[model samples]
Target: MTATCTWRIWGLEASLTVTDPHRLGEARSIVDTIVADVDRACSRSRPDAELYGRSIRRGRPTRISPALCTLVDAALDAARASDGAVDPTVGRALVSLGRNRHLATESGRPEQAAHADGTLHVGPADHTVIRRHGDMLVVPEGITLDLDATAKAVAADLAADVIADEIGCGVMVDLGGDIAARGETPVGGWQVTIDDGPDEPRTQIALQGDCAVATSSTLHPRWRHRGRSMHHIIDPATGLPAEERWRTVTVVAGRCVDANTVSTACIVKGAAGADWVAATGLPARLVAADRSIIGCNGWPAPDRLAA
Candidate 1:
């Protein structure tokens, strides 16, 4: 008995698949609760969000809720894994580049692309100084935190875990494009359609065992800033959106958080991304701006996924 449920949450589409059809309702409630909790704790655009308020009043140590703590830790891990390519300390950088608010509603607006005035200052990973001990987190007086890269994926992982344990059945959770699954898998596993971009052809993959998949793209969440096209994937070093190289990158990893980390970092890494993704030994698909594609670490060949 298998069933699926899809809903809108936190400005993204969320879907839950359960092996036991009778447990679908229970699974939906679990995922909804998890997403709401995560949004309240860590949403970058929510003024009332815990992360937003804390970013405003930094300097002293603040005790965070378990959910926020988990997200912060995940962000830190992503930064460390990618050697700061996926820094969470870029919150101020994002705001300076006109990303302080939600992009889903304001995308493609020049007003949403305010010119950055000052130099974007973020030092090496060690000197950046975001310290965490248990649930306590401390940052520089003016440093803002943005965990958008990993937060949603972590939320999906949490939801999948809870649904599988509580219902004692196989479960899959997809928040936006970050996906995680556990327990039993369908005969061919979960079939996932990968969206390369508007101009590129989409492809499909199957997730077997306990694994996760995530994709980061410059094609979406885009806008015009100062008469130039911009996107949401900011490079911390420049405090600006990454330049066009690969339109999108998708990765498969043991956890959704990890997969998202690699995908986002690859976008920031630019031309060196291919080598970086290869080093990680994960299957990945990278689509160039011209719609040309690159496969790494054993991803399906272009002929196999061509539009």
Candidate 2:
């Protein structure tokens, strides 16, 4: 019997497929268990989630769940590699930009304001401190963290690994457009559609065997703040939206976490990001804001799809 199911988890619609003459029921059970576990581990809105606990607590390193720890550790390493181009402690900035709600929700709430006296640190892979003085939550001189950019990728990787191990079949996990796949599938590779904002042409990417793919673009929802349009991809150096250079960047790497992490960093890196991605030897496609496309290193032009 062949069965497929689609449900929302980790802020995106996750589709699971299973094919087996026997153990169809068992397959469904395993998929459901993975979805539930991923939701509990990565849902940012959940106040009790390990991520939230760490974020809410000012200077304390709360003991995180193993799954959450894995995600965080990956994010921290990415932050270091990018020289702080990607950060995991930008929850406060994301909140301030009115993106404080879960992706599945229809409405968003304004981020609570930090205490007036709060000071934040902004640098590459350094200890950050935040303190509260009376009504103000100070960032303790200079410390900034933004993990929203990389957390989704980490979660996708974790979900894919967990699903493949438990079900012993192919697993495709997508957090928004970022995806990771493992095991074997009926099709030669998974088919992925890339949304390049509005009124622009969409592209497709194929993943075979084991690979992680992540797409970062400025075309997502945004709002005007201080007379400038603000997007979700924050630059840790300036604590502001990244400058518009490429409209979108899609990267394929050995792991979903790396793909997702580098994609976000590439957005902030601008034209220089192309060189950076090429140097890493990962296959990547970049779409400029002008609609021109460029392929880097091992990545081929969109016309050439691997079969």
What does each candidate score in C-alpha RMSD? Answer: 5.0, 6.8
Weakest 10 consecutive residues of candidate 1 by summed lDDT:
103-112
Q: Please report how far candidate 1 places residue 113 from its true position, in Å.
A: 17
Per-residue lDDT tens digits of candidate 1, residues 199-283? Answer: 5757888888899999999988877655667788888777778877888899999899999999998989999998999999999
The whole-model lDDT of each prediction reads 0.80, 0.64
TM-score of every candidate relative to the true structure: 0.89, 0.77
Question: Which model scores highest in TM-score?
Answer: 1
What's the lDDT of the predicted structure labeled candidate 1? 0.80
**Candidate 1 positional error at 11, Å:** 2.5
Residues 273-304 of candidate 2 have per-residue lDDT tens digits of 98888888888888898888888776756568
What TM-score would candidate 1 get against the native? 0.89
